[model samples]
Target: MYKAKIFVNYKPSVLDPKATVIQQTLTRLGQTNVDSVMVGKYFELVLQGNEAAVNEQVAKLCSEMLANVNMETYRYTLEEVEA
Candidate 1:
């Protein structure tokens, strides 16, 4: 088995309105130390496949469907796991 930890985030060039709102809210609540906030997606996936195969498939999915190449960037860490 394989375990995949994936993170999807908006490109730096893309404006994150949700994160901007969160940052503003935090500032209003007196958490002024926070410089900024960016929202993203996180996922833990368990797959029944070899490391090489799982890695390839995960990369394919990330580029093809999991993230928007133009505006979002995605990265994943794959590791062996017990079945």
Candidate 2:
């Protein structure tokens, strides 16, 4: 078995309105140390198949469906799991 951990985050140039709102709220509450906030997504997947095959499929999913390749970036790492 293999376990895959995926992380998806917004690109630097892509501005997140929600994060901006959060920062503004914090500043109004007398907290101004935060420079900015970025939102991201995390996913954990368990696969019961060959490592190479699963890695290929997971890469495709990240590039095509899981992440927005235009304004977002993603990476995944896989590790062997003993049963």
- TM-score top scorer: 1
Runs in model 2 lying further than 4 Å from the true structure: none
What lDDT is obtained when candidate 2 is compared to the true structure? Answer: 0.91
Tell me, by lDDT, which candidate is best: 1
Give the alpha carbon lDDT tens digit for every residue of 3-28 in model 1: 89999999999999999999999999
For model 1, give the 10-residue run with minimal summed lDDT. Answer: 43-52
Candidate 2: C-alpha RMSD to true structure equals 1.5
Model 1 regions lying over 4 Å from their true place: none
For residue 45, what is the lDDT in candidate 2?
87
Quote the lDDT for 74 in model 2.
Answer: 98
Question: With candidate 2 superimposed using the best TM-score fit, by how many Å does residue 33's alpha carbon deviate from the native?
Answer: 1.4
Query: lDDT values of the candidates?
Result: 0.93, 0.91
Q: Count the backbone clashes (under 3 Å) in each candidate.
A: 0, 0
